[model samples]
Target: MPLPLYLLAVAVFAMGTSEFMLAGLLPDIASDLDVSVGTAGMLTSAFAIGMIVGAPLVAALARNWPRRSSLLGFTLAFAAAHAVGSSTTSFPLLFATRVVAALANAGFLAVALTAAAALVAPDKKGRALAVLLSGTTVATIAGVPGGSALGALLGWRAAFWAVAALCLPTALGILKGIPAGRAREQTIGGAALRAELAQLAMPRLILVMLLGALVNAATFAGLTFLAPVVTGTAGLSELWVSVALVLFGIGSFVGATIAGRLSDRNPGAVIAVGGPLLLIGWPALAVLADEPVALLLLVFVQGALSFALGSTLITRVLYEAAGASTMAGSYATAALNVGAAVGPLIAAAALNTGAGSLGPVWSSGFLIAIALLIAFPFRAMIRADSNTEVLQ
Candidate 1:
């Protein structure tokens, strides 16, 4: 809702694009560096690993620092990393830069999530988070594609340079827009660190985090291999893969936007209704993989349901971790990345079993089914406010 929130979203767009655009640039990077495409793919894994480790580490280190300064520092660091990465001829150097960039990106996102929630009223926290996360969805729709096109027109290095250049204005905007002294003044010392760490023992908090991770894992299990599903199974041409991706991205954007408004009022209802639809959509997609038209439509529908449920779970994390520590945002970020790291691995295992494109879809279905079971008994707990008595 606030201008500062939008500015954070802009920063997110730049970082998000850098995170995902590598998918298109991997071939170029691999060929230029004399590495195989599979090796180049590790760059994505490196980023994911960095994000998982960095969110909590960076957030803890900067817990005493002002939010505005932390954001600006991370943004600039990310830009610098990209600049170095683009210029590097050495694969090892490029890989190191990817790790560094991911660290900066994770730090920025962790702080940005907390800052965005702080920028709004308690009741508006969900909407604020939605607005902040919409940047990533929009990145999926526009920024990633734009980066790919830039890579195609110029060179892969050009796309990196472009991301670096975009960050300068984002840094300037953060400095201009975010107010000073907005850091976690309440958690400035050793006691605060202990308090943050102690959150790991809270059953309710852990449950929410687990749910967030599981839902995200399920979403990615299918999402990562969508190209094969669109082309190999659906009998579509290569061009249709891009169309399928765009349709999914559009659905994600819409779902997240709507879920933000709804989750604030009734997160339980949002999850309860969306979860079943998501569970069913995965299997339905797998069953209809041969039907090009159905596959395309289901891709869109599945994206909507996946993000709708995923965003609601993330919003729930905010509330569940309320008043615990500023590290709450770090917890959410880490959970999501954990899922991002694990989902594709599970899907890969399924694929190894000769399941073809359908492996990922079934894998997704299995994961969501488990998520629903975990959340079912906890529905009352999820719906209850953090300050209220814990539902048994």
Candidate 2:
């Protein structure tokens, strides 16, 4: 992997921290801003909305810009937004900053994936993406936890300031490591652009996007309540809950690494293998939610499979959208965030509607099953593409 790839990962680490760190500071933010917890929670919704809407829109509008310039521009924008967030005491101002920051995050991530792919051979896109995604997994492990701890010690505003500070070096790294004039979007006429959009509407492409959304829905529906499930059902202390999260994060990192390497040869198989693994894992988790050992192991495997599904889906989009790589990447990013936003809501609704702790577990299983069904035709498409590649 090139240094630029790792630098892209650094950028993702900062962005991912911003995305998730708010989960731990919602109460503090509510108290500080003199709003209800529920009101403060809307900051998260704002960020997700920005990512979902901003990614594809920015990618399309900036399709004609120099890739490196877009990358730098988005990175700085993110940092600046965080800087504003760090200074703001008003809830509305903070919410607005988060939305702008997420817009920058969405744009940067979409371009980073395409830029990473552009640096590698066609065959290595999976691994290259895996390398890039490792940053996100690492963020789950380090960045979120670190932010939470920092928030606990200094204050929630300090966490935002910290994220802003981190971005400076990341921006500098991207400037130094990434070559100028690389990964520029291909120029095309209106007719050609329309044809690329047409390709994006294909059943196979649509299936890939749906699969991406479903996979995130399945995984996050369960994950959003991991702490409660572990502590409530397993009768573990709050500390053990943290242990479970770390285990899951470790599994995700390992899984992403392995998935990247395997995706190079057969991203379809990665998904095929991953989907069933998820189906089995979630149900087992429900059954074993009370068993500490079983819960730990299942959470790890579930996390791994979740990330595998994510990497494979991105690879599929790249393969299908050869000419419109950034658009495809942005769509994939937005689709997963859409799922992320939806999954927790589904789980929350289930719990609120008299479904016990086990509700999310079963809900995840059902969602994964739906995703696999959608993936069936997608798998065949990938296999056909593989066979054609072999022949060529």
Candidate 3:
């Protein structure tokens, strides 16, 4: 509801768009570079790796900087990344640009979330997160499919270029709308962040972050391979497959909106529901649906549920650490990015091997199961702590 939230959303929109658009660009990227699809897939891998590497480092480096300056600097870096990524000809150069984007991506999220949390009241912190995440959700619908069309008509470079164009205006909006001084991070906050982590490291909340990362890892692993899953396994045409992805994006966007609201009411339920739907959706792709409509429905539900509780989980971490909120938030962000890196690498390997097209589904089902298992013993602890109004 605040102006800063909307400013963050614009930045998030560009970030989310760049992140998801690469999937749709893979074929074009592969063809242009004369590489295998598996090889071209490195773009996704590179980005995740960048995120995993950049998140904590960026947080630590920007620890002394004001949040506004951190984000402003982050935006400039992100805009450059898109420009480089869009214009590069060689694969290695493009890969480097992706890494740049990834670094900027992680930094943007880490900084933005901290800022978003700072902007809102303590009670409605979850909704503030939801507003930021809404940009990402909307990206699934607006960015991924739009990028696909951009690649189709003008080449994948065009998609990146469009993303680059989005950056300028977004940066301007952030500058204009956000309170210049208020948007910055603090030096004491950084030292405080470290101290908070040391003092308030709640085991149960840690478990949730770890588990959340793992569950989402499976989703990423499968998500990265969705085009093949649709076209190869489902026996759909490429064009139709793109259309299906568009629908999936639509579903994910809606799911994210619902999850945002649900975080206030029932984050636990939102997460719990995502797991089962994903379990069903995973096997369903192997033959869960017979009709085209049925197939689309299944995939849509899968995407929606898979990422359903992303903001809720973040909110929980922040909720648990009332005093050391930034540290808790940073750790959770780092964990998720680590999962993003690890999940797809493992999944790509699975799909590349003879494990079948359903490799990601199995990975996701197993990861979600693992995450759930890890979180089981801590559920009561978490509930107790949430009731306590502090995590650590």
Candidate 4:
């Protein structure tokens, strides 16, 4: 709703592109750096590890800083990381840059989540968050594909340079848009930090964060291996892999749009409806992996359901953590990246066990089932919250 929110989303777009575009450039990077593709793939693992560790750490360290300055610092740091990465021929240097970039990206996201919520009315927080997350969905649709094409036309370094260049305008936008203030009225100190960390042990907050992580794990499990599923299982051409990804991205965008509107009114309903659909969808995807038409259709449906449910869970984490001094956004960010890391690990294990391309689908189903079971007790709480909102 606000211009600043859009600017934050634009910054997220640049960061999100860097996060995913590397998937397409891994082969080139490996070749240039005199490493195997598998080794280059560790760059992704390094980024994930950075995000998981950096979110809360960075948020706590920057808790007392002016929000605008912290945001600008992270954004510029991200751009610089990419610039160094683009110039590097050493694998270790490039790997270190990815970690640096991921830390900057994590800090930016953690701060931006709180900042976006701060910029909006209480009732509009869901929509504001959705606007911010739309940047990632759009990156999946346009930025990753464009970066891949650039890498194909020029070189892998070109994609990194492009991401760095894009961040320039994003940094400028952040400088212009975000207001100078701490995330909260009360600044965090030693005791405050300990208290905020203590909040992580709260049962309600832990449940919500776990739900968010499980939902995200299920999502990435299927998505990380979707290309192989499309080609190896469905017998499609390489071009069709891109088409399937686009379809999934489109579905995610649409699902997130709907979730944003509905989450504020009734987050329970979003989860209630989406959770069962995903439970059914994942198994169906596994069974239909060999059917081109069915696989394509299910991919879209699964994406929509998974993201709709995932977004709602994230909103719930924000709600549950709202009382934390400064760790609310960091908690959500950490939960998200934890899922991002764990999901693919599980899927990869399944594949290694001779499960073939359908391994991820089955793995997703297993994860979603656990998520649904975990969410069962939360229904009463969610409904009570919804009722209170309606009464207010």
Best by TM-score: 3
136-167: candidate 4 lDDT, tens digit per residue: 98987788767766775788899899988887
List model 1 lDDT by residue over 231-272, tens digit each: 678887645655666777778888888897888668888888
lDDT value, residue 77 of candidate 4: 94
lDDT of prediction 3: 0.71
The candidate with the higher TM-score, 3 or 4, is: 3
* Model 3 per-residue lDDT tens digits across residues 113-170: 7677777777788788878877877788877778777787788888888887777765
Name the better of 2 and 4 by lDDT. 4
Every candidate's CA RMSD: 4.0, 4.1, 3.4, 3.7
As a whole number from 0 to 100, the lDDT of residue 125 in candidate 2 is 84
> Which of the two candidates, 2 or 4, achieves a greater TM-score against the reference?
4
How accurate locally is residue 310 in candidate 3, as Cα lDDT from 0 to 100?
55
Ranking by TM-score: 3, 4, 1, 2
Error in Å for residue 196 of model 4: 2.7
Clash count, one per candidate? 0, 0, 8, 0
Q: After superposition, how far is residue 25 of candidate 1 from its true place, in Å?
A: 5.3
For each candidate, what is the lDDT?
0.79, 0.75, 0.71, 0.80
Query: Mind giving the per-residue lDDT tens digits that candidate 2 earns over 1-392?
Result: 77778778888888888886665566568779998644565676678779899987877666566777889999999999999988988888988998899899988876776678787788888788877866777877778767766776777899899888887877787778765654455665677657656776777777777788888877767776665676678998645655666677778788877887887567777877888888998999999998999999998899888888777776666666665634666767777878777776676566655557677778888899998886686467663255322101
